[model samples]
Target: MKIAIISPGPFSVPPVKGSSVEHDIDEVTKMIDPEHQVTIYTRTCATYPKSAVEENRQFIRFPYNGPKPYLRRIISHIRKRKPDVIMVENRPIYVLTLKRHFPKIPVFVNMHSHVYGSPGMISKDKMKKVVRRASGFFTNSEFLRRHFMKTCKIPAHKIHAVHLGVDVSPYQVAKIHYSIRKIRKEIGLKPEDRVLFYAGRLMRAKGVHVLLKAFKEVCEQDPLARLVIVGGTGYGSNRLNPYVRELKQLAKPLGDKVKFVNFVPSAQMPLYYQVGDIVATPSVWKEAFCRVNLEAMASGKPVITTPRGGIGEVVTHQGSGFLIPPKDWKAELPALWKLLWSAPSIRTEMGKNALMRAKQFSWYATAQGYLEVFETALKKRKAASPPTKQDLRKTG
Candidate 1:
């Protein structure tokens, strides 16, 4: 099967950092069978050449001048390659363009989360039109799938859910123990400090302020408790923004107990997991599926996340980690204390369980799942009514 995956415009293939969706695309493309040819169309960056091929996978870049120019470039490229199935990540608005030029091809939109609230993306009405017209829709979590279905009035059969995955090898318990102390020291963590790690965007919606508030309470109860924030302004931005400033101000009272490492490369994230006693992702909004939880679990560390969106699907409450309700620090405080300040044996057992659970999700499995969706959608598209010349000319 020939596949063309269109990633979001913010980053290129083999993302250095802050491109979780692209990373997902890269990982899945790598594990795909050699018999199947894969071409990933991503945004061009200074680091990447126009075209590069590795193994069965090929990467092609296009400039992100604007939606009009981007769509024009995409149409020109796809007309040449004419892939069997086209899979686009996020940005539901792209479906209109694909349908206009490649009416015969099956197009699947893999949504990480709904972007309705985000600035300058497609509107809800446009997204609904995309959902109705596309061959199929997929989301990283069931929560996202259900939400999309309900919001767009699409049938359940049109949407599928595949949990996000992590490369569990580097985060194995053996590897973590090998450099535990060294990584801890490198991150400015003392031997006695019990670190709570948070790795994602520093935006308030991600619950950074809430995490700081909860950490302040934890520190008041236990001075040895520490919080390590490991992210910049997410979505490929390198510079610190006002949100980062706000978080810094929030953590000021807590002083050096809160450590901000800015943006750590995705390749080096395992070290942060190893140094943390517990991973916290207290997102106020409903996340589709957070890769941070999977990475932490793979590294043999317990995670304390909110019970919103697809998080419930990823975490088993009190089994692998605690799932506290979002923004309810009253509930969050106790859970944090229990995991971080309580018995060492409890944390150890939970970490062991987390590692076991993490093994269930793998990039290979995710890739295979995506292939199944592509095949099913393609077959369905083939069986449906033939595309009329009128359909090909229709552009919205």
Candidate 2:
């Protein structure tokens, strides 16, 4: 099948850093069956070319001056390509427009977050139209599927839940152990330090401030406890803001116990994962499906995160990792930190279980899930389509 995938338009396909939706698109496209011809429509970057082909996939880049221009460029190319199906990533409005232009073609939208589907972003009437017009809808988690059903009144049958995945090869135990010592030394982490890692946007919604408060308590109790905060205020952005300044103020009391590493590239994330004894993604917001949890599990480290949204689906409570409720994080985080720090056996066991669980969610599985949705949608479209002139002639 010839597949056309439309990116969210804000970020490049192989995202520079910090766009999980783009990262997911890039990974899934790479893992898709070689027999299928895949074409990706994404925003152009200075580092990338206008168009390029790799294996069975082709990438077409367009300048994203605004949403109108980007859509115009993609629509022009898509009309020429006439792919078997079209998959719009993280943009519900695009599905409505694309389906209007190419009514016969099955256009599907994949919702990666609640931001686009909310009533604030798109009206209830338009969302209803999207549900009625689009061939199918895909979400990163069951939580999000239910969310759309409630918000947009979409039918259960129209929405399908396809979980995101991680590339577990680089995070294998042997590879991590080999480079961990060097990485730790370079980061000035002492051998005795029990590092607690946080990698995501340094925003209050992500619960970074909450984590800092909890970590401050942990540090007072355990001299070896350390916290490493990764990522910037936004994707590909490390510039300081009010929230960042506030975070610094919060961390000041803890002093050198907290180290902030701003905006590491996605390619080098595996190395950063190795530097952590445990990974924490204390997001207070309902994350659709966080790749950080998967990456940490794949790295053979137990994650301490809230069970909000699809995180519960990814991290098993007390089995693979600890899932503290967002409200209880202030009280529970320090306690869990102490438990994991004091008991090496429990941490090791959970880490092993985490690695095992991580194996089930691979890029291959993610790609196959997407292909199944596309194929099913295409088949349904063909079945419902009107008979061609050739079919009438054959009957005559």
Candidate 3:
């Protein structure tokens, strides 16, 4: 099975911003390589240095300036490569390109998120036009899968749900333990400080503002807490601390209670998980799949996250850690305090449980799942009639 994965616009293969998307593409490509030839199609951004192949994986680069007609450029690459199955891992634009360029191939548009109101996905009408025409579609969560089907009217069978992957083995193999104070010392954190970590895009929908508010309360109530926000700000770096600056301003009321560092490379992510007493993800919007939560849990740290979005499935409430209501919506801070001031024994137990649950979401299992989808779609493509205009109208 020779498979070609077409990642959507402006994404560098190992992705500078969204590690999950890049990591997903990397893992799937590697997994299928043993049994199948896999080629990944990603962008050559201005930032992407000269490509020198290092790992078993290869990075194939192409020029892309902006969103306009970039999909044609991608399909042009795919048609030349001639993959058994072409997997496009983003939506809208690529879907349209598949319709125009490679209408014969089994093009699978795997969607990770959907838009609501506010100038969504081309026109909802035009998307349905493509969804009606494409061979198949996929989303990472049952939540998103249902939404895509309901909103787009694509059959449930045509839309596949592939949960995103996380590497659990590295954390398991490199697992370490330390007292809260000891962990603090190791990370240059203060011995007296209670560390709360938030890593991922610093955006309003990520609920960074909400996390800042909660952390401020956590400090006012506990007096020993410090918040460390990691990962690059999501919207353009030029965008005025934007939502992030506002969060910082709110935290200024509590001196040294907040710290913000934009962009932590993926390799050093485990350290952020290791250094925190409790990890925080307060995303107000649907996160589709919270890979950071999986990463944190893999690092054997208890997570504090809001149950809204697909993360409710990712982190079980009070099971892996605590899944509180939205930070702004919640009425009580005492529960947060109890967890913050918890005894060493309780905190250690929660961390262990978090890791236990994290093991359930392995990169191996995720890769295997993707392989199944690829094989299934490839088989369908092989057996089907040469895609005709009539085939798009044929109802299941």
Best by TM-score: 2
Q: What ordering of candidates by lDDT runs from best to worst? A: 2, 1, 3
lDDT of 1 by residue, 286-386 (tens): 88888889888998888888888888898889988988876587446755575555688888899999989998998888888889988887677667877
Backbone N/Cα/C clashes per model: 0, 0, 2
Query: Any idea what lDDT model 2 has?
Result: 0.89
TM-score of 3: 0.86
Model 2 C-alpha lDDT per residue in residues 1-396, reported as the tens digit of each score = 999999989999889865888999999889999999999999999989999999999999999998878998999999999999899998898877788789898888999999988888788789889989988888989999999889887889888998888878887744536776887776678998899999988888899988888888788788898899989988989989999999999999887889998888888888898889899988989999988999999999999999888999999999899998777877888889888867889999999999999988978888898899888887887788898999889998
Worst window of 10 by summed lDDT in candidate 2: 171-180
Quick one: best lDDT, which candidate?
A: 2
Model 2, position 233, has a per-residue lDDT of 86
Q: Which model is ahead, 1 or 3, in terms of lDDT?
A: 1
Candidate 1 weakest lDDT stretch, 10 residues: 116-125
